[model samples]
Target: MKITRILNKIDRRFHPSHIYALQPDHDLLRENRTYREAKDIVLLSYPRSGNTWLRRLLANSILEAQQYPSSIQSDIPFETVVPSIYTQSIKPPCLHRYDEVCHRIVKSHEHRDARKHKTVYLFRNPVDTLVSWHHFVSNSPSLLQQFPWVVDLSIDEFCLNAVDGWAKHIQQTRHYKDILLVEYEHLFQYPHQMLANILDFCRIPRSNIDLDQIIDNQSIRKLKSVTHSQELRKGGVGHGEVELRPSTVTELRQYQQMLNVAWKPQVERSLMTAM
Candidate 1:
């Protein structure tokens, strides 16, 4: 009761927009069991780890299976329904109710609750990730406007943040226990069979989405080539391989040496175990 009064006082003291600012209207997440009751799946991944394409494929599958009436985008729209989701929004927005959809699969780059439902963590080698990310951010003119500094920094400078500092945001999905780590190479190499493993694990049935049709689409086919977007860049699996000149690698190796202290091992072990 005292805590509630204090919280209320804090709420009353600040501007509602500031107090909640971009937050959804949920008094207490304690009662929000949507993510908990999810008999479905959360398609979790770092930005540009083929999550968009995966979601597309999943949407096509659901459509083909005839299990759903709308696109996968419609089947699960988290920003619209979930509380405090403040990333990018979907155009021709997806919308749904938990009980109504046959299965709801969410694509989120957000942090996960270790206590909640299943997760699929898709990743790529960091160099490849940076390459794809450069294209992704540059191509979206709006994002380009929002984050102008991204353009100012070269890949090496940018990676200092991705690798040097807050790298955990991308690397660790933190404590979600049911993560299935899928590397980008394997996904490209075996889209159908890999997707099958994901579906089967989630208990979703195999989809009738023409495995060939979706794969055959030219855009989908071309996604493999980072060069496809030259203005953005065309870095690949081992781009960093070349970028790390002998001196750079030596200096960078020291940074890792510093990071490889007593506490770091335990932390990495814990993160990998969760993944």
Candidate 2:
């Protein structure tokens, strides 16, 4: 038993998945200095929760608004447009064409440091989030190269381990004075209105950019063709209920109940009914 426990400890110590694990507050600023330096706006979400899609959309729109020649704006490297903690450790030079908001928007999956910046929190139903996250982590080439163990995890095991982080993220960032809550489903159902809301929240002028053109440019089909990215998946809702196990659903619901208790006054936005 002792030897087995020691082996388990060693396995976890060297696990690549620890890259996504929440860091202690003291180490967070040092480890995620790019995130700490982000100005005005930060886009926050748990992994696989539409953060990438939204970031690309915003970046493209900003470039268009600035009237960047189509050639320059055609392939907006999202990591460059919005300094991401996951992608860039040193701050990349800000693209010159777009205004200050473009430089200020940063993307992050972790939660603890969000309160320091005005945040746009994107959340999805926990069931769908886990299902999508499982697919992303298991299939991502970079993660698999170093830690093939991820592909071996059953969906149940993955969801069970990951269930708490979603709620914990909400708990930490919900009350910040400058936060905007964006539900992922709303992006699908009401793309125009949602985009406008986010632009307004981030203080980007909507008049200069054609919202319709930006949305079309950022559509999943066009983005996939242009970037050949595997990260963009089938992005509509309800996959969680269809893909996850019954036990996993129940566990996720329990977490939803906790989320409800956390934001009971905002009953209309409750996950209990939303999911």
Candidate 3:
């Protein structure tokens, strides 16, 4: 099994046919299928909602605190540390260890029932999410071709559709046994404090480095420079207000208000404890 896990890692790394491919492997899911202690932390969000950015931040913090060799730390891909279940196999060698020395951070865009994992739900303003998602899908030739109507939809129409999806996701994930709500806007506004809350939620203590230093080192610009990733767009607040029609903005805000009402207690509790 150890050899198989190693092979799986190599297969994913090099994608050579000679190596064994264990992708689509449900071993981890099946192994952790039953409810147990030490549940993995899931970083949950909708697409284009700052999942990658937050993942990078979490991964950096974990690696530093765990005292992983600087060589591996420097070269290890983000997915190697915080993998996406949608794309990466779960049976990689890096994931075999489960302890304080090696914490698991998984990225997920979907929710499943009957799981006992702790979740950190990244909530972005739906209006901003709608605009960002539109640009994201529109830019992809495959997505545009598959959903031709997507290109034709007005911002209002897109917002209507996007809001429904957001509501459904929120409704689905709200019932998780353990959940932490981290607002995208608040992360930027109160980065140092918000990051501390997130680390504490995930049980990741800061290394000798200060919290402000961690935030400074993991800026979007630095991450982009390191990974050369184009997925990160203009990250801040008020994109929806700037681009969407007043009516559309009003509708999204109404839905946002409803969500706020639903999760107000959790949000308030997290805020109070964050300090």
Candidate 4:
């Protein structure tokens, strides 16, 4: 067991692709300015809002269609298909390749910027998102150390903080003309249709692509089984109903009111019933 743990640590430390695991407060905007400027497509979301899942789906679809090497499969060093500027290490070979790729698909969790990239904004219910994020950080020692508040606060307190951040993120980017809004619930419920919609929005041809294959490949179970990382936790929807405290539900409702989110009524109703 000790040897196995040691090997796991070594693999995580040296893995080429693990470099894309994002650190808190990463200065991706400043470091990746040139790549961002040239990128034609972006997948934007708040942390824990299904960004990785969507990235994997898009990567598998596009790479397979292009007949790229199988070595760069969904969760491997597959950032090239859709480079996540925020998470990818800004070093030599990756940096050089990022600059060279045209119409690149970049992932970001930062506030919306003035770049003209066609954007897909993935959002989830703040309640579930926070719950997932709380568990995610709690499981990741590195992430918990980076954001110590995750350890300092109860899940309720964390959700309260998360709601405010989620509101601000939504307010910042929801108005963009070129942005496509894809809700996590919708994606969970209708994977194929949602994938098709995303492809259509991105102007990618869906006729030749097998949506079912992409959906199967990116299913939550498949991702969790394949990845050794704890990031992919229980992938079902609406866990907040059972998991979140009533106080957190109230806090989220108030935030929705303050932000004047369009889905406020629906979310509030859900929260009330959940509580």
Candidate 5:
């Protein structure tokens, strides 16, 4: 099987794809994009949140203006996708403080690091995030270890973590400006506008990018058919009870009871949301 991994902008010698940092620390040099020079527009999100499709659209839009520069884009994904082939890909190795401009397009599930870089944050209702996460990463030996709760988590327990938000504030925070908080629901409904916003964030020229072409683009289909297939579903509002066993449902509720009441509605809504 062919594993998909693409190296983004990074100084290969100093910042290998093996290491990762919350924010890049590009150093200075004559031939590289220093931290000051790294004009990055990153896509931030948790797993299965649809950034893959977003990134592709951005790539197509940018490539179109460039006019088939030399075979479109060679294959994207910087750290996250590249490391995924190993089965437990989490973060990439860190690079030196300079050469940050090596890859302009990047995708990561790691909580956002670079506090100042422009970012597009995508969030799914915690319920779906958790359910899909469990299904997608259930087989990942890494997730099993990182999230000990997952090993023996009852369905309810699973829901709690999903909604509790990731360690770095999936629920709320005020870290940086230029962030576009995109709920998963809007992405499917307004695919074009969503794409436009992303390009806008990246400061990418939008002249040649066709939003419709991207939605129907082969890469979108390719990703769904490949490793990312689990995400094909867009999600509804509620009713997981329909598919889960009574025993499992009971177990899930046990954990759900642990969350703050404020987040309950959101979590409950996503459980049944098929996306």
Candidate 6:
């Protein structure tokens, strides 16, 4: 028993994936305790659910044209404007000094809580999200180590699992009265309109915000061109039919039914307002 326990500890130390699964909440609390007081805007989503793209959009919208590049390389320093709580190595400035800034956006993928901070939850089709996530995790060595299950599952299995996962994510955050829910498909379909909505949700005046320029610069083509990884591949909706097998498609359809039932009212309301 002692030997087994010691081996498990050693395994977790060497394998980050095991550690993450075992102590996700503890890790999140430890890493994000500082930001509890000062988070101004919470950008919440499941992993691979358009968080990075939205961050780019928000950062570019806020930054001056010259300061924000047209084509962003993988290493662009936009974290100060829209930092991710999950990715930050040091203490987040937003936690200490959000009042000093005009807009502080913090990204997260945790389950929703009762925090009163303004939140924007991004929702993508689970089929597309899972497909993207699978490719993303499979391609990145670090991600593979952290999420070894991605390598073991077929695409259909992943989508079936992701359906349940995303449904839970939606159920958790859907009821937040102050939250603004944004659909990933709409962001692509109507970039100007969605950006305008997001800017409004963040309480930024659209007067000086050039929606045209931000949309053009942050378009999927431009983003994919600069991002040299599978993470940004084919950033459009309905690609799941192409990438996922027929069995996966059938399974995803059933999952989509559950998602629509849970999210239809909120999503419809958002779309109506956007229209």
* Each candidate structure's count of clashing pairs: 0, 0, 0, 0, 28, 0
In model 2, which residue pairs have backbone atoms overlapping below 3 Å? Answer: none
TM-score against truth, every candidate: 0.56, 0.77, 0.78, 0.74, 0.58, 0.79
Model 2 — which ten-residue stretch has the worst lDDT?
1-10
For 1-275, candidate 6 gives per-residue lDDT tens digits of: 01112122222232222333344455654566455544467888877888788888877766632243433442345565677665553255433233332556777676432257788899888788888877765677765666565666777665665566566777778558688889898888987888788888887665556778777877788877676755567788898788778867777667667778777787778877777
lDDT of 4 by residue, 1-275 (tens): 01112122222222111323445535653577554554467788777787787877787666555544332244346565666766574343563233232346777765443346688888887777878877876787776554554566677765655565577677776457786777787778877777777776776665557778777767888777778664566667887757877866766656645654575454344334323
lDDT of 5: 0.47
lDDT of 1: 0.48
What's model 6's overall lDDT? 0.67
TM-score of 2: 0.77
Better of 4 and 6 by lDDT: 6
Clashing residue pairs, candidate 4?
A: none
| Per-residue lDDT of model 5, residues 1-275, tens digit only | 12112223312321112122212322211112222223555567766666555655555565555553312233543223222211222323332111221235444444333356666677654455556656665665544554444566555445444443332345442456566666655666666766666566556676655657655662443545544445544344333555455654554454334432544464334322413
Best prediction by lDDT: 6
For residue 219, model 1's alpha carbon misses the true position, in angstroms, by 6.6
Q: Which window of 10 residues has the lowest lDDT sum in candidate 6?
A: 1-10
Tens-place lDDT per residue, model 2, 1-275, is 01112123223432222654433332533555643554647888877788888887787667766775333236566566665665554333543345564546777776555767888888887888888877776766665665566666677776766666667667777568777778787786767778887887788877778777777777766766656554677666887787777867877878877776656455334333333
What local distance difference test score does each model get? Answer: 0.48, 0.66, 0.66, 0.63, 0.47, 0.67
Provide the lDDT at 114 for model 3. Answer: 20
Q: Kindly list the per-residue Cα lDDT of model 3 for residues 93-134, writing each as its tens digit.
A: 645343464457777665652257788899888888878877
After superposing all C-alphas onto the true structure, candidate 6 shows an RMSD in angstroms of 6.9
Question: Residue 242 error for model 6, in Å?
Answer: 1.2
Model 5 clash count equals 28
What TM-score would you give candidate 5 relative to the actual structure?
Answer: 0.58
**Which has the better TM-score: candidate 3, or candidate 4?**
3
